[model samples]
Target: MRRFLIIAGLSLAALFGLAAPSFATVSEPDDDPLIDPAPCVNAATDGDADNVIAVCTPLIDQEKTGKPERVKALLARAAAFDRKQQFDRALGDYDTALMLDATKPDGFNARGELRRRQGNRPGALADFAAAVKRDPQHQAARANYKSLALELERLGAQLAVKNKPSFDCKQAKRPVQKAICADPELADLDREIDAAHQAKLRHAAAGTVSRRALLRAQDAYLAERNAAFGRSTDELRAAMKARLRQLRGGKAD
Candidate 1:
């Protein structure tokens, strides 16, 4: 499975002509301390969630700091809130920061990541797209947008499959098939694979050696996947992600 994933990744990279940037995980905001309120910045950036909230609250309430410095504090505090899973507060701060400085991509990217974690795919997609529009070279935003696009696509395919399945869910006897039917995430992956297979077939030229080889490879992959029922869902998801990258003609982000 690992070898197949590697091969799929290579195929995607070849198709795209360049390797896609890796997706960025959520992390603390970049620190830019103010000379006048250096302690507020330090507390917001380096302290724990509670300390960040306590210190930033005053700085925010006072409104004495410059807009740039205040935005930095807001972002740092927002990151701290996010770390503590205070999503509403974090989102509010991110909103304020963006409102204060609408030209920058940082706030949008940060909020998009937060929205993704909050299971708001549409909001995350919009925010990521906005970030990319503001700065096309922003790798984080691009990766986030691509990842969300793929997920939403898979979800749509899943819904379609649920309405008109290629396989009979009621009569699914195999462990792998049962697992796929029982888990929505896995079901979505299954639908994505089916869609990719059909797409490949539709695009393949008749009587072509390469097309024949590609079909064989796809069949082999499906067979192996079906037989590996004991594998964890995480493993299956990773494989499906690699396959999706191949189907999309782009390296994994």
Candidate 2:
């Protein structure tokens, strides 16, 4: 169980690296806590605790009625993108819908699917968890909850590898083990990440990249990689992480 949690955590951390590769078929929601808060939840209510409650309750009891016409349009467009198997666009629509109205768990669930398709399992789990938490009775939220368990398991295993000596990049002179060797994308990512970690290590490795630098790279990487791979979030993230660790000199388990 602990192992699973570790992998999930690590993969989630690495997910943004390969997100541009594309994974739109995963069929989950795309709610980013970092980018934009849910619009429904973010609406400026009367500031009364009760007013806030009343505002949120409608999204559940009224069945998306709280969502504005624009919100609905965005969601519809996003759904259409899903139908066309254009996950990146679908994810964009989902983001717009959530930004327009955060109360819709369905939007969150839908966006989570896009993240999952992009190999962002941790993100998918977070969005799925958020969706169900906001509305326990939501069918989509319920389904997404069940969908994330496997992702969690895969994340855990990858995390174990992350913590092991076999996967540690900082300590490595050469990534000799085939078990440790990463794929092409991961290889590129590894080099990029290594550049970053090297700068942070001890006095900083020569030609090192900073944490701030990685943050910038992370954003572009997520959008680009998610659009590129289109693999199961956890699997793709795991593969990417192995390479990224090598690149960034991420410490092995």
Please name the candidate that would achieve the greatest lDDT relative to the true structure: 1
- Per-model TM against the reference: 0.52, 0.37
Residue range 1-253, candidate 1, lDDT tens digits: 9999999999998978756566778987746443455776777656688887777766776635788878887888888889898899999999999999987788899999999988999999999999999999999999999989999998996566673334778998888888777777777677777787788888889779968987888888878777775857777777777777877786553
RMSD of each: 32.3, 34.1
Tens-digit lDDT track of model 2 for 24-127 = 67656744222222443444222333333334334423433444755654665556557667788678768867887788887888888888888898889888
Task: Highest TM-score: give the candidate number.
Answer: 1
Error of 1 at 198 (Å): 10
State the lDDT at 176 in candidate 2.
35
